[model samples]
Target chain A: MSPVSQTRSPLDWVKTAISRYWGVVGVLIAWQAWVTITGVNSIVIPHPINVVGDLVFNPGVYLANAGQTLFLAAAGLILGMALGTMVAIVAWSSRILSGILVPLGLIFSSVPVVALIPVLARLLGYDVKTVLGIVIIISFFPAFVFTAAGLKSLPPGSSDLFKVFGASRWTRFVHLVLPSAVPNWMIALRLSAPPAVLSAMLAEFLMGKSGLGFLFRQSATEFATERAFGTSVIATVISVLCFTSAVAAEKFINEKWK
Target chain B: MNAPLSSAPATAPEAWAINVDHVGKTFTLDGGKELKAIDDVDIKIGQGEFVALLGPSGCGKSTILRLVAALEDVSTGRVTVEGSNPTALSRAHRLGVAFQDHALLPWLTIRDNIALPYKVAGRPVDDKRIAELLALVGLSGFEKARPRQLSGGMRQRVSIARALVLKPDVLLLDEPFGALDAVTRRHMNVELQRIWSEQRITTLLVTHSVEEALFLADRVIVMSGRPGRIIKEIQVPFARPRSPDVQRTMEFHHLADELTLALEPEGHH
Candidate 1:
């Protein structure tokens, strides 16, 4: 059955929208109510309305920082996935290589990736490249692990069929092994993509001159609470967008592939 | 109907398209214990002959087919096709095969799935041959349909079409309809018989169904489980271009019952 069913009526669309987004809506309403009840000083914690005003009024500032962060995250995610897939294929091909690399990959994945950012910044220099590296490192493990598993889980008896047909190594990889890994690769993407955005922002926050992370830091230091709150709101939106888009892509591919 | 296992002639090697020369296969278990899957099995399929290996589950009839398909190495003796090693036939892209799972690539359309042999063989896709096969399998209009869109029987048909597209010297079918319902399986046997009559390619089918074996094969070799060995061999007396009504005949039932009795456990009444 198709997961992307069409809505039959306007009422159906509204019901679906509420079911999907009620949690986020509820959180927003609670935050607004708390701000109104407290009557807190604006400099300490600005009203939700004030944060929205800053976002609406100063689109140019937010746009430039957001664009930078988006580019870094997207670029890092693609490179990481590509590298992971290549390594996985190499591991699949050579027993010795997999024996050495798979365990190492596991170890790297187990360590807190966020903790590595400051150390990486010191070694790689405090720049955009480090932020990109952080994002890449964060995204790599899931892709590598999932792709390796997928490569092994071919359709039942397909490996035997290919052997009987006398498929060349490269031909088998292209026609059988690579395509087999697609669904699992989509899974890696869904798991890694949202984290890619978060890692990029965190790297920017630690040691960077631009991006939403730096904007947030600058606003907080200067007592511009509304701007800081606006950056957080934008960051949350971007992260959620990444997650949803990855999920959508996965569903679309699985419909055709599975 | 049961004949001595070794009575098969050891004459001209060229006449035999697939020759399993006293083959045996053993597997090393995870615990390092040896498990004998097949032992001292011999089968010689003549050129354009249809032979079916019928046995119960775990009887290693499939292992025999796998040996001839060059998918597994025989622990003892050898398997040859057309006077050369079985692997050689595979390397030449002259071996066709279908299994219980169908094994069609789900992402591809029916036409492309059938054309996969050509792609694997590094030959240009033959559109005419693919069309011919699609029609041969009675799936001509389903060229654009992916494997997921088709029924199980339809998918198996596509796998069969793909196997035959290359016009291989030998066809190996390992329970190609084993997963289908009774009605569909019977229908498929009729379809396969019709298809085989046109091509007349030498085929070796592994199955558990006595009726199916009797219906589709010129000869049936039944095996006993546990270090599998051929226990009974029967030359089917049914004429070519056999109709489904042949199954209702007394002679067919007589053969089926005999084979079924042979398949039963020794102590079972």
Candidate 2:
């Protein structure tokens, strides 16, 4: 029916696919070339093939570690986002509370959060709970800031309309403020997803009994380069998955809420 | 159209639908100096009357409407609605208002936007009433469309529908068609007249357009610039169910010219 439908060809399909995935193809080509030309020690940097082989042969180990890391990240992300949103609601209710906490949130967000991982591990005793806590603290700031902004950024005159309608404070918050804040909340989710995974891995790498970060550490210590590379690959895959899902979620909400 | 309430009862003491008794509004500037926006402005609207406050920009016409809508407190004097404070009327969900911006909620459909006042009043959503309002505003088929999907005039109609969904005792319109183009504005004015004729609610409209004031209102009050005060008042002679042809009459043109002259800067006329 359309010109594009009529002119479409297999070559066009190949061109579209290459345009979409050029970065991945380029990276793989570069990796293989480097491995072939350098003739470097496999112990330091294993071939991509060897890493793939390790992933295929040790699926159980990768799966278990990935599951732990994902669970920790997802659980921590949910807890952190919930706490942040609750605090944002509280801030919205009281100008004095917003004044007190908004500056504190800004300061904490500006600080290097990862630098506090070791201190937190030492203080909280280097357990899985501490790892979860680390991820939560890292993810909390964006949620707070974005949700706070969204709560205040109402449609012009709609606030006055609400007031003139004699809306109770609770009704205004529920019907107007909460819906207004959803798009910004989704933005916070998308921005925080990768950090959630990264922070979970960092926390585990610092000190944890199990997870991908712990697996990488154990493999590196044992001089199993292929297994270490496999863990890195799996972490990359999980982070990408989390980020993409969050982006998709944000898109869905923006369509409905905007 | 329903007949306006008889003048006999309206002539009784303290029987006005809205009473702005010597109201004055002063705003404090950033450096602590005060700017008076309106000075000793007095206005009263009878039950079922449509009164338009015609003024130049920054003349505080909107401030008058806002006071009656309970969106702002009167800086001086008293504003009463039906023998009580404006706040009480609003609290009872008997006040409706539409602003120039047509402030429909972007997240809501036209139906949901019109139904918002019910939800705000903590009442059950009346789908039939919402449907009726949609039909009244000529938006029956657009109930499921969001505000942004509609044109400017359509959005204003949706806003007007939202304002009237509760069948409020008093309606305040602050240049509700101010953002529309000239042709669309005239068309909307006709639509609004049709709609208002159906409801016959007591209304106060703030606008600067002489033709609009002449066409849509039963009484037009002309206001002067800064420190806004009512300069002149004229009872429109045209009958109800007025057609656009009335706007072309010699009487309408003469009144429009007189009002336009009154709106000019003080030394110009």
TM-score of chain B of each: 0.96, 0.95
> CA shift at A88, candidate 1, in angstroms?
1.2
Runs with alpha carbons beyond 4 Å of true place in candidate 1: A1-34, B1-9
Q: Which DockQ-derived CAPRI band holds candidate 1?
A: high
Winning candidate number (lDDT): 1
Worst 10 residues of 2 chain A by lDDT: A1-10
Steric clashes per prediction:
0, 0
Please provide, for model 2 over A207-232, each residue's C-alpha lDDT reduced to its tens digit, 9 standing for 90 to 100. Answer: 88899999999999999999999999
Which residue pairs collide in model 2, if any? none
- Residue-by-residue lDDT tens digits, candidate 1, B21-40: 89899999999999999999
- For candidate 2, lDDT tens digit of each residue in B180-242? 999999999999998998889999999989999999998899988889998998889898788
* Cα lDDT of model 1 by residue, A50-152, tens digit: 8889999999999999999999999999999998999999999999999999999999878786689888888899999999998888888999999999999
